[model samples]
Target: MEVLALLCIVSVAFTGLTRGAGLLPDGPLNAAVGEEVMFTTTLAPTEIPFISVAWTFGDKPIITSNVENLTEPEYEGRITFFTSTGYLQLRNLSFNDSGEYRVTIVPRGEQQKTGTTRLDIYAPVSNVVVASNTTDLAEFNSTVRLSCSSSGSSLSVLWLNGSSEVTESDRVQLTDGNFTLTILNVSRFDQGPFRCHVFNPVSNGTSDPVNLSISLSVSNVVVASNTTDLAEFNSTVRLSCSSSGSSLSVLWLNGSSEVTESDRVQLTDGNFTLTILNVSRFDQGPFRCHVFNPVSNGTSDPVNLSISYGPENINLTKSPSQEYFEEGTDISLICSAVSRPAALFYWFLNGDKLSDTGSELRLMNIQISHSGNYSCQAFNPRTLRDETSQPSVVSVLERISGSSVTPSTNLPIEGKSVNLSCEAAGSGSRMWMKDGSYLILADNIALYDNNRVLSFRPLTKTDSGEYSCNISNPVSSDGASYNMVVNYGPENVQIAGPSEIRVGETLTLTCSAESTPSARYNWTLDGAEIHNSSVFTKDNTGLSDSSNYTCHAMNNITGRTSSAVHELSVTAIPAQTSGCSAGCIAGIVVACVVVCAAAAAAGGGYYIYTRKKRAKSTGDEGQDNTAYSGSQELNYADLMSFQSKDGVTVQLGSQNNSSKDARDRVDNSRPATSSPPTYDVHMQRMRSAAQPDANGAQIYAQIRNS
Candidate 1:
């Protein structure tokens, strides 16, 4: 009856019996249970307000007006009415709610209009499951039936083996709307994990997997061995077999015969492993393993064993084994031995092993140094043994000729370019050595022409050396030597001397310079040549020595000269001193010395005082100023201590330079010490001394005894 109602409703929707046109797509609309559905009307635009809107499901009203409680009791809270658009929606619908639905809209001044559609609700596919009629199945004997079941309405079912849909044929059949599958006379290929899919107009579902457990037989089998190589009496071996399927057992075989257990041979791991101890040469066999069950049997591939033995009776042979070979000849030597595994070989020259590792050694372009006792050694890694052959003697002969070194020029000057080339009569390699050591290349030095030439740009003094060129080949070797000289600078000339020295002390000065081919020295005073040696000395320095001295240096090869100057000042050492100032000295008369001589007769008092004596220079060519010497560094000399009657102690130091005579008192204002001392010798500032000769005049009275 429900189906008949849905059919009638669908016929009314598709036909032109519905009132509104262009409303919604014509339908018996399909919906699943527990889902929502909506209906909208096609009330044409009228520019008039809607006076009434109504919706109905079958004969019962779902929504009619805003003030009426006319909605179906089951749809009370599930219905929504849009009065302006004349649309209706229902939520959480059930299978019983499927029927004809209609919506009516009444404009203020027009006749009522209506839209009608059919809503068909279906239950969603759910809870799908698959089951097999029988669990135990066998190939060629058993049958299988797979059944699919689910809960839903208006559903269709399908059978699948893996991902492909299952179809009926001679051994297969699908019954009951494809909800059941059956296979007769099942083969091993018919073992399957099968699934079923069920679908309705609104939904679809798939069931979990089900499978037939058909009894299987053996198919693939393989054998593995412990070792392919076995020593004759020093090894053991194991072989194992493996196969697929159930209820399986293993068997061992050598060729075609069944293997039995013995003291030396045994089977373990359910006869899958065959072990042989103290393996012998006769034990080498092509072995096989067999796997079998009640319904099937299989054999593994054969495994062959190889027995290992010895390296012995070693011998070596030489090709072109002549006693003597010319230099640059080729030779080959081959070594052999009786070995189970082929032996590796090495060559020896005079008992020292060469780098060759194969059974053969080849020497190309041999040199005289290759002449020696030649031999070979053989080693077997399997047997762990070694054998050496008897030695064969070889000799090579050759000669070296015409080796020489030539320079770019006969004379090399410092700060100039030069190169040296080395060559021999034949083709060979050349190396350059200096002073018994390899020549080191520096920023100014370079090598070219396969190291046959050495060059120096802006050659320096360091480049001078005894150089040797060594040329050599397999034929022979020869070397040539040379002595090179570079002429360089007479520069940075320096003189070592004190700038001032006391008269009567030796005044010495020495000069030096940086030069190659040793420098010559010359000394000059005031631009006049005085000496031609590196050192100059004056045993008795006089005032004339107070002048600039020069030392000159010359490099003969480079022909350059340079000079440095030294200034030497000579000062005289003064005599002793007493407390009498020059003031006291000039005032006392020579008659006082006479009076002192007269006092010897009376012994009234000691002579008054002894004046401090001053050493004077009269006619020095480098004459300094006038009546008194300037504050020179020599003033501290000739100090004399004097004490007056009141115990007053004073140091009187001589301060004078003569104008062919004596002159002034001490110049107190001028500092007399060379260093910055706290105090100085000051004059008493008595009445000024008597002015003395600017022209050979004397100031002090010289007392004479006749």
Candidate 2:
């Protein structure tokens, strides 16, 4: 007994040692970046001061305890341990240090034991920003710059446009981490908001986006002329620049650089003035007035300088205020302007500049395409800038036949009225002119109806005309002549049939028109020749043989026609079945016949016996058969009765009779076809199939009959 007790205690101790290994004292260890943490173990007296202190990440030892080498790039300054202290310390922790660190102690001949600690590092995110110049509307092509930046350690910067990151190009420049975005030459295409974001491994943050708009503004310096128009090669030009304020320091650039003195170019008090000794095409180009002002350091819109060439005294004479041009006819525009240096001659249609040797712009053979907003800009070398006249709208009028003006081409009854209107191609404003000349006072036409509207109220034949509508404004005038045909037909015409009717009875058709002078009515069947069908005669009545009718009305003077169509139906009684041929005798015969019918009722009793055998042999059960116990038989009887009353006999055969019956012809003449042979056959089949034969007698009967 004493030996057994000692053995049991030993066994218990072995069990605990095997099961509880590495369970306690193995919890996860944690630390953060740039911080020092240590793990320690005990040592015996006289233990070598150089005892191994193994360093590792997870299960892999980055530095073996036996190597004793400390000056490695990855672990050099990041880790350290004292010989006597029996402690391991990690310094300046980084992201790579975020893992398990373990050390093994192997004091001479003793079993080795191990312990672990984990290191974690956290670093903050970098910064970002978006930048653009602050202004709208710059010159067509020029240089501009945008920039982005961030503030963080070991930083990286990214540039974003909307949602995508953009790369740098020759015209687009980017800096190191500074993220400077440059647009070499700015145009309308380079307008948008830019965003900047800042992030690092530790944390992330972003900056607000900078919105930019670009536009065009006159440069600091420009040349102008006191005279209305500039002449070619000979004109006095005045040069000017900002005398003070923001653009005061702006320097003038001629062509591409600062304007210095040439024989023809002179500057008085820094006001740029250029005198062309001889006016020629070589001097015509864009002149630059560059401003070096610190406040407005960027480039300004360049001023274009040109020489004048066009007909002189370019005056336009138009009657009917705004004259409508007709193609293939002669029309003229007299351009005239006085000049110290007589202007060269050219002609233009619309804004299209045309060249001519003489002073007048004449179209000997005009065309429809020539119609447009026409204006003239004149310039000469003596004048600094060109002058442009107000635009004149020239319409090439070509009248074609079959052009009619009505309030509407298609209109709903009672929804539209006959209002004759003028379709004139000119400014939409209207004014009155008597016959051909002199303006009519505003009072002559009703204020509500002032816009060339000829309303026909109870319209008469005299309303038609060649009336003219004249439109004018201070700048121009126009006129339109129209032949107003006051046309209207029967409106709100109703042809109602009699409400009460007997089968094959006739109904009267009354055609009434709610129109002026009561439009004349003509009746027709379908869409055939019309007939008056005298009012006293009952010719428009609805009869059994009559087709659908239509009533048309026409206005005699206006010659406008309108019609309404209506379906005429005669009433008749539906056919009901007479009593069955033999009354109750037939019904009794049908019932008796059903009692002896062949039945194909389901074999639930057999299904139950078979199911039981299957369940017993398989050692399982699915369900018990329950049939023909309640309403099933009644359902079978009801189905037979319905088939009897409807005279439908259902029969069973090798080939389904249902498929064959579906191909039978349908009787269109009679509402119902002749009755099938008898309902007795269907009833007999139902009754005979309802009974069960224990010996399969029905199968034997079918075989014998076949």
Give TM per candidate.
0.36, 0.25
The lDDT of each candidate is 0.72, 0.48
Q: Measured by TM-score, how close is model 2 to the native structure?
A: 0.25
Worst 10 residues of 2 by lDDT: 605-614
Which one wins on TM-score?
A: 1
lDDT of 2: 0.48
The TM-score that candidate 1 achieves is 0.36
Provide the lDDT at 335 for model 2.
49
> Candidate 1 lDDT, tens digit per residue, 1-706?
6577456445544563443344444678888889987775544333345777777778888777744436768777998876656667888989888888876666665466577788899999999999888866656777888888999999899888888888899999999988888899887667667889999988999998876666656668898888989886689998888888765778888888888889989889888788999675456778888887655678888889998755567777777867667788898888888777887788899999988778888888988788898888887787776778888777776655788889998778898999998877756678889999998889999989998888999799888999999987655789998888888878899999899886556888999998887899999887899999999988857777899999999988888899999988887654533345444544343334443454444443321112233323334433332334342333322212233334444323333534312222333554544332112122222234442232111222222211
lDDT at 203, model 2: 48
- lDDT by residue (1-706, candidate 2, tens digit) is 6577456534533442321132113324444456665654333223354446566677665555544644346676666665553466777776677766666654443355555554545555544555555444354555556666655444466666666675787676777554677666555556555666555545456666665454444343444433323445565444454422232344556467566556666666545344444333434435555544332343445555565543234454433245576567666665455553655444555667766534456667767787787665554445443445566677775543222234533221232345556455434456433345543333222323556665444344444345566655443456666554444456677777754453324457777765544588888876675567413124323234345678887766445677776665654433222122333223333433343342222111100000001011112222221232232111111111112223343322122333323322122232322222224533444454323332233323332242
Residue 524, model 1: Cα distance from true site in angstroms: 3.9
Which residue ranges in model 1 land beyond 4 Å of their true spot? 1-398, 502-506, 525-527, 538-545, 570-578, 581-706
